[model samples]
Target: MIAPLRSKKIIVTRENAGGKIFSKKISQYGGIPIEVPLLRIDCDDRDENRRIMKQLDHFDWFIFTSANGVEYFFKLANKHQISHEILNAKNIAVVGEKTNQKLKKYGYSADFVPTVYDANTLSKEFLAKFQNPGEILLIRGNLSRDVLPSELKKANLSFTSLYVYKTTINFKSKNLLNEILQREFDFITFTSPSTIDAYFELSGYLVDKPCVCIGTTTENKAREKGFSTILTPKVFTVDAMIDIIIDYINKKEHI
Candidate 1:
């Protein structure tokens, strides 16, 4: 029997390491995986990150918007030799299951995870539980949306934004860009708005092929960039996105 993604070429636009994982997932179903990392995540070196690490006990909640935030925050924390005991009394909230998993990797787990995995939904759910908002620390990337911070501000809640990482375009060899553009790809996967923006920056056009987005935020960003066909999984996870893509491919093949 033919595999679901047989003869299909899928473009992966995650960072260097993440793109490899997505590529491997695509290959499992017989798809030709193309690694075209559009963006790279770098940890911030500003003293503000260290300041936030020191005041972990002062903040009522520590919110993480993405896995990058969790990874970079802990990385800087370890570099500064900050003790994890400071976070013992603080509540941790994560935007998605992936972010939660990243937190768990450091021997910690999220106290609050919204039913839906986006800033808008997270703000709503978090506000419903803790009306006061109090002093909060938000560790996120530079490209993160202002939905949560803006919502908190409107509600007169006090919070500090601790940018832990920045996403920059990873446009390397011109040959790679040309290779990606010249290939006939069946689909492309976008994990964040930065990836979508970086892809457009490199390609100078919207994706003509179908796109599979990890969540509504990425799908919305793609739509705003003039991508006509964007698919999103009900559950905002890479595994769920792959399942949706395989299902879509099987259905299309049958038709």
Candidate 2:
């Protein structure tokens, strides 16, 4: 039998390491992966972030929206010599399975994860679970959406945002993306809103190709950016995105 993604030229727009991992997975299924890393992720170790790390005990709940958030949060914690044990006193909530898994890597587990892995769902469910919850801390990147925090404010819940990392456009990848776009590709994958923004910024114009988004938020962003054909899996992961692409290809072949 042929590989599911055989001969498919798929554009991967994740950051460096993540793009490599995603490209390998695409190649595993016989896809020709074109890696155009659009976003650069770096730990933000500013004094304010360090100060927040030092006061981890003030929050009643800790919310992590992405794996990068979890990773950088713990990295800063370690840099400041903050004990991981301090997190045991707070309830940990994560947005996705990947974030939850990343948390586990630090010898911690999420106390809550929403049924649907999105900020809106997480906020709604979190509010539902803890009607009278105490102060919350949102561990996030620079470009994290305000949906969750806005929701918390609407419910009159107290929360503080701790930006643990910064995500910026990878200008070095612009020429590479332009060179790759000269050729024909089948599908493009976007993992986050920042990636989508970076693509438009670098590429100047959007390609008329089917786009696979990692989740509803990304899909919504793609739609807003005038991408007509968008595919999003129920599960918001790179693996889920690949599976959806395979299914889309299979269905197209049958038709």
Candidate 3:
């Protein structure tokens, strides 16, 4: 049987590690993956991170909003020679499968994860399960949404939000820029709203092209930027995004 994404060229705009994973998935489905990374993740505010780490045991719960958060958090841990036992007292929660998988790499697993991979849904799911207010530590990136903390506050829960990593725009390579100008990409995938912004900033315009977004926030951002043929999976994960792409391709071919 022919591959669902045969001859389709999908542009992946995630950062280095994320882009590679996304590109591999695209190739697995017979799509030509274009590695046009739009952002780079960096560990920032080392002193602040160390301060937060010192108090890691005080929090009742530890939450990670993305894989970068998990990665940088562990980096700080290893740098400071902090024991894994520091996190033993707190219940852990991660926002998505990627973050969950990253947590697993550190010999840890989330105690909670939302069905939908957005801050609003994570807040609702967490609130529904644990109604009592307590000290919560949120490890996230600089560009993270306020929805999670805002919802937690509305519920009378106190939390400390830390930026474990910062995301900055990746300078588009000349070849990639030329590819965008010359090639006809079948779909452009944005993993976050930041990626969408960086992509448009680098490319100078949003083309009238089909787009796949990982979650509602990115999808909404694409729409705000005048993307008409935007698609988002019911579940916000990279695997889900590829599945939705295949389904879209199959539907188009059938029509």
Candidate 4:
């Protein structure tokens, strides 16, 4: 019986509010999960969030870029008693199916979602859908590096942004740093470039094992860190990463 994740110490580098859930998945997979939050969030413009929700009634469309953005936005809306009628009135747009699923969880459906996931694809789809250039409400987090909004502005679309949550780096996660240096896992998983950035910042250029990342950028980061056999699935999601890891394990078992 060849067990890939079974009883193996798997490194999970998910930070922020999602860290606990991330750890839970690692444990459920029969691996020793480490909970090390590499990022923390603080709402810098708390009042600005309310002000943005207050103006939801003014925009021609609403765009949600992340699942975190959706959760935080609704929390703020419910706090101020923002009615469902106001939420239901707009032409809604979302980045991916996950974002749309989250919206449906809150009793809303995204009228527009890009076929592919990511700001670049969403930006392209939005541009293709609307040519007249109207006002939009873009609800997002602290950092959005992808030039989606810039592309919209270039198309002459006016957007009011609601900054609900801001993410900050954690420089003092000694346990997380030590685990990587000690090489304490059979496998390590990275879901985003930010996860790679936060981890390498702590690990300081030490790599010698199997690693699985969800996308090309993360795979590049893994290669930059000297990981020889990095694995990447077609889609950048946790389930996809798990699937790829299982395939690798199955291949090894057959050999």
Candidate 5:
């Protein structure tokens, strides 16, 4: 039997390394993956970031919202020679399994992870368990949403946000994105709001192809950007998004 994604050309708009992984997954299903990395991720090495790292012991809990957050946080921590013992002393909370796994790479594990991977669910469930939690530290990227912090504020919880990384548009990908869009593509996958914004800015228009978003947050951004056909998986993961795309193609083929 032919694969569900056989002969389909899917556009991958994730960052560099992530795009390669997504492309590999697409290739496994007989799909042609066009990598058009729209966003670039960089670790923040400012003095302020290091200053915040030095105060890590002051916080009661450390929350990581994305894998990038965990990766860059540890990168900066290691660059500044922050001891693992110091980080291991605090409680860790992550938004998703990927983030938790990233945290584990630094010899730590999450003390709290919500059943759902989205920020909204993380905030809701996190607040349910730790009503009177003390000073918390949020490790995140510059483009991170205010959902978690806003919830903490409403509950009168003290938290300090430390931006460990920043995601910006890959200006070098503009010509490539234009060239790729001119070709026939079956689907476009968006993993974050930054990717969506970068695509729109670089391309100056939205494609009519079916858009696959990793979660509701990205789906909402796609909708806001005027994408008509949007597909989102229940589980917010790249693997789950690929599964959703295969299922979507299989159903469409039957019809």
Candidate 6:
């Protein structure tokens, strides 16, 4: 039987002091919300954005990795007075289902999205037809892995990256940490690698409580930061995390 979920608090450390949607979900599941933001965003460079948008016709695909990346890309495009038609390339790619919706908001549907959100899965699926493609314009944040770009190069497909934003530590959340650490929460959710980094920055040890992660990447980050046992949803998402956490609670009760 599933264990009762009541009076359990899970902290969602969103990058930009933004987790309203996540907080709502946790509350719906009987989990109290704690605000401990880990990172903040600032636009780093935009010069390369103009150069690419001006030559938009030269690109075969415009790929996005995050909702943040998609938001900033369109923001920059709109800022420079670039036409919406410039974004209609032969194809478009994104990392997650949510990011696909972000693209839809810009009036251009994404052509490719992974069933599961991750760099390896996204690249393998993209490369199937990417070998015959022309240059691709990969829009991402300041820091990201070279795995995707390197794979494209090996397949002889050219691609250029346009970093639209920067992710920096939110050194302003020290007061928030004191409140969070003083009170022990029932569950802690790690949504990104930076979130895990921020936890250690404040307290050397992770909380002695249940931990949930959105994806394997975040799961690994949590495990590295002294969280030995973490629950990673089979599907990487906030909704998926709920389903998995519910199931895990039941299984642990049986034991």
Task: Report the number of the highest-lDDT candidate.
Answer: 2
- lDDT tens readout by residue for model 6, 163-208: 8888877779867876787787767887878778877886666677
* Candidate 1 residue spans exceeding 4 A from truth: none
- Tell me which residue pairs clash in candidate 5: none
lDDT of 3 by residue, 1-255 (tens): 788788698888888888898899888888899887789888876688889888887899998998889999888788878798777777999888878999999888899999887788889999999997479999998999999888988998889988888988888553585577577888889999998888777777768779899989999999999999998999988999999999998898799
User: What's the TM for model 4?
Assistant: 0.86
Off by over 4 Å in 4: 1-4, 220-228
Q: Write the per-residue lDDT of candidate 2 for residues 45-163, one digit (tens) a residue.
A: 98898788878889999999999999898888888899989988889999988899989998899999999999989999989989988989999999999999899999998889999
The predictions' CA RMSDs to the true structure, in order, are 1.5, 1.1, 1.5, 2.6, 1.1, 2.3
Error of 4 at 148 (Å): 0.7
Q: List clash counts for every candidate, in order.
A: 0, 0, 0, 0, 0, 0
Scanning candidate 3 in windows of ten residues, the lowest lDDT window is 172-181
- By summed lDDT, which 10 consecutive residues of candidate 1 come out lowest? 171-180
The 0-to-1 C-alpha lDDT of every candidate, in the order given, reads: 0.86, 0.93, 0.86, 0.75, 0.91, 0.79
Query: Measured by TM-score, how close is model 2 to the native structure?
Result: 0.97
Error of 5 at 60 (Å): 1.1
